[model samples]
Target: QAGTALLLLVAVVVAALPAPSLGWGVDGHLIICQIAQGRLSDAAAKAVNELLPSGAGGNLSSLCSWADRVRFRYHWSAPLHFIDVPDNVCSYSYDRDCKDEEGVKGRCVAGAINNYTSQLLTYGSSSLSPSSKSSDNLTEALLFLSHFMGDIHQPLHCGFASDRGGNTIDVHWYRRKTVLHHVWDVSIIQTAEKDYYDEGAGEFVDALNKNITGAWSDKVQEWEECAKNQTACPDKYGSESITAACDSAYKGVTEDSTLSDEYFGSRLPVVNLRLAQGGVRLAATLNRIFGQSKA
Candidate 1:
């Protein structure tokens, strides 16, 4: 009886623990990169091929989650994955919202984007010095850009300060108890039935690329215009996300905090929008960095 009781107690403790994951889950990131790849200029395509494994056949999506996979080896880089705005504020300012875990300023996701973008430029210009010996490899800069673009658009990555980007807000995904961040990270896409999409992430991304028409393609110009302007990029994307987190992602919930079709109905479109924008913006950055002029 004591053994059985102890087992029950252990299960209770385990069930209450929090599991934190970063950036869009593997699939979301993949889809974002795949979309970006399809839109890349021919010169950018050649540059990407030089950076990634030829065995992978120049697929940028293959490197989409490289930052997350190497986090332990690059411990300081973990904070570069997200930014937290205060409870009511939606916009991101480098000085205000880009602090790391140690309270040092300008170390968050937005700053990472800026820092890595400069590193990427080293490949384009003869006069520019690489950001660091650590980031000397253009591949790392490209990978970081690929990942951070997706991170910036995840509403919860740009979510509230109190929750560490929704890592604390407990919510049930149908029957499984999980945090709000995970819901956004993995659930929104994975929960869909396979009839509508493939369960395999690479395949799912292919589907998204094949099905994505030119509807949002023209919007790339505006996204690039805002992103290129340092004062506007993070502020625009981060603010838009947190505003949605407040208005849609976390808006309706009782003590139960159950996520049903009503919740998905509202937030999924937001997810879809972010995925589109991230891809478009990433392509724009690559084009500017690796276009024929640079090559």
Candidate 2:
């Protein structure tokens, strides 16, 4: 009986763990699809095609693969000095409002670069080296970089001080004790499935592309503004405040409801827009490193 109870407890604990969240927008995938489809300068298209499997499939998974690899190769060096710091601290700006000094770091951009670089160095180096040009690890690193770059851009992935990037903050999403980060990661993907229903990869690609062009500027501006505003630091950008904002923004909506036109409605545009920007920036970064001009 005692062994059975322990097993059950272990199962419960495992079940309660949050899922991995990937900070991606629909537009990111859309831009990849557009680039794949459009007139690429032979070299750029060839590079993209090599990254993608069949030079098709513009789904989130495909795009994520591309982004992960790109980011892994470029930003791996920046994060080694900063990951141990709390998200709130990392996101905090002393210039804006200095409250608790315990967990607060500096600003999000620097933090993001730090966090991103750390993940890359840890994962990418073990997988590939920057000096080697002709190894499979290099390929893997590029893919990891591609996905991680997108991940860091996500405001939440930079993390929050209070809840460990929403790990601790518990809330009910349709009665389940879901954390803010997990909700953004899984629930949002589930929601995307329900709304803007796409049966085929082509349709999915089309949807992603259409939305990406529409929202890229706004997403970049949002990050840029946040970077510029001193007041956007610790006090306002803390984990608690971010958690509250996410809960308020995306609470009751479920997978089934999300599929409906009324689910996310127009708000969905932001996803693709961010994705597009990430992709463009990612490609640009890669070109610079690989001795290729930006496409």
Candidate 3:
């Protein structure tokens, strides 16, 4: 058909373009941050505002993907964005599992969270004099938290060592050449919510905010409790995602990489659950750090 031919042409054109800097994609990051903002405590909200740039309208969600934007500038930080776990290990031990390209231990997303959290607390204290460097550091920490929160929840980010987080396992999403990680990072969300693909950025975000369908409402408390504990550390997120990557992220791969409808349907719930969990945890983290009382 003529329509089908046109679509294939478009797909070819898109596939030729440069690949996006892989996070949860722009929409996924925005949705997570936006949801967190709504749940922020008054004290937490105030604290977050003090750290955000004035240009951002004191809105945390607006800067959700700032880390990825500054990735090339802060090249060393690229490794801190993800964890590489071997297949079926299904566990994260900061002492054993954390690593980066430079063979640095404790240099992945979980470590970044711990580091920024420490920096936030240190720079956040009333004892320290307010200086531009400290202020800048605090802002950077906030941005990292905003972005890393989204990254940790993406199953592929915690993927196996052999596949480079599914990057090496070649795949295609809807006839376009892509990798397994790319599918989760880009296509799954779009395929699942294709109706909103053409919608304006804000329109899609508004739709996500309005839709409250997921398992997060029940698990927010439990997840928050787990995150609040210091000993849980990497396992709180990394372990869970790696396990899921083994269970769900690689489900549709075959010789042709044609993802069937079943794969999309099954993963849609996962996409939603991960987003919800990331949003709730982001809010809970800020609440504990900046709320009326610390955990």
Candidate 4:
């Protein structure tokens, strides 16, 4: 009965926040691919290997699919919020002044860091006792860390604090009722599926690396800029503004419209950049935790 209730709760959350049908479909694959590139140091490899089986045979493509499933279940909606709050105007509000509100915590970066630290501490504690060491728990923690790191890099994930990251800002994704945040999470990526990098994991990692090298600092800057100039930021206010900004961000990339080309063309660079950062950072975190050397 306890297990059944937990399953029901998970179902409700997944339904309320449908997993983004983003191009990769599975994110774990991306993380594993990054790991296999041999770019990571020996320590990182040992850490990841400790979590997986000894001789799990498969190329990058197959491994990636496996990783995606593991990551999705563990952290599919982890990007939604660092700290859950009650449903209220403030929940959906992005007003700068709300930063001081009792449950509010700056932005997604701070939230992601907090969540990562908490999970790691919990895992450390559990691993201390032989009876408490569960393979499932460690795997889930690694997957969550992998996914959340990726989430913080996503501009929309950081989101406007006022509107519950655009949850309250209702809009349409081809006639379906969706929020601004949802569109960014799934719609845009779905639209890019046609051009997705479906080749080997190495190729995917290489492509992602090129983008990440350029965009990491820029994304951090964008977040900081948003934090500083809350009012001047276009998407920091009302629903219309949120919708318009999202639409513009994903216009061409996710839809077949005149706005498609420019929109898709522009953001593609940013997407690559974020993915790259996710892959490298995932490797870095694993190294630190597992005592691996820098790759």
Top candidate (lDDT): 1
lDDT of 3 by residue, 1-295 (tens): 9999999999899778766545788878887898889888988888888889999998888899889887767888988888887665766677776778777887888898878876676545544444534443788998998789889999988977777788787766767887788788878877756654464446655555555434234555676665445522445788788878878987546545777577888887788778877887888877767753333
Q: Candidate 4: lDDT of 286?
A: 52
Each prediction's TM-score versus the true structure = 0.83, 0.49, 0.83, 0.52
Error of 1 at 178 (Å): 0.9
Candidate 1 residue lDDT tens string, 174-195: 8889888888888988875243
Better model by lDDT, 1 or 2? 1
After superposing candidate 2 on the true structure, give the runs of residues whose Cα lies further than 4 Å from its correct spot: 1-41, 48-136, 199-204, 213-269, 291-295
TM-score of 2: 0.49
Error of 3 at 277 (Å): 0.3
Go through the candidates in order and give each one's C-alpha lDDT: 0.77, 0.42, 0.76, 0.45
Give per-model CA RMSD.
5.6, 9.4, 7.4, 9.3
Q: Where in model 3 is the C-alpha error above 4 Å?
A: 1-21, 126-136, 196-216, 231-234, 292-295
Which of 2 and 4 is the better model by TM-score?
4
TM-score of 3: 0.83
Clashes found in each candidate (C-alpha, N, C closer than 3 A): 0, 34, 0, 15
Pitting candidate 1 against candidate 3, the one with the higher lDDT is: 1
Query: Residue-wise lDDT of candidate 4 within 113-231, one digit each (tens)?
Result: 43553455344445467786644455445544555554444445443445554555666655566665655555555555545655343555555555445545455333223345221
Q: Put the candidates in lDDT order, highest first.
A: 1, 3, 4, 2
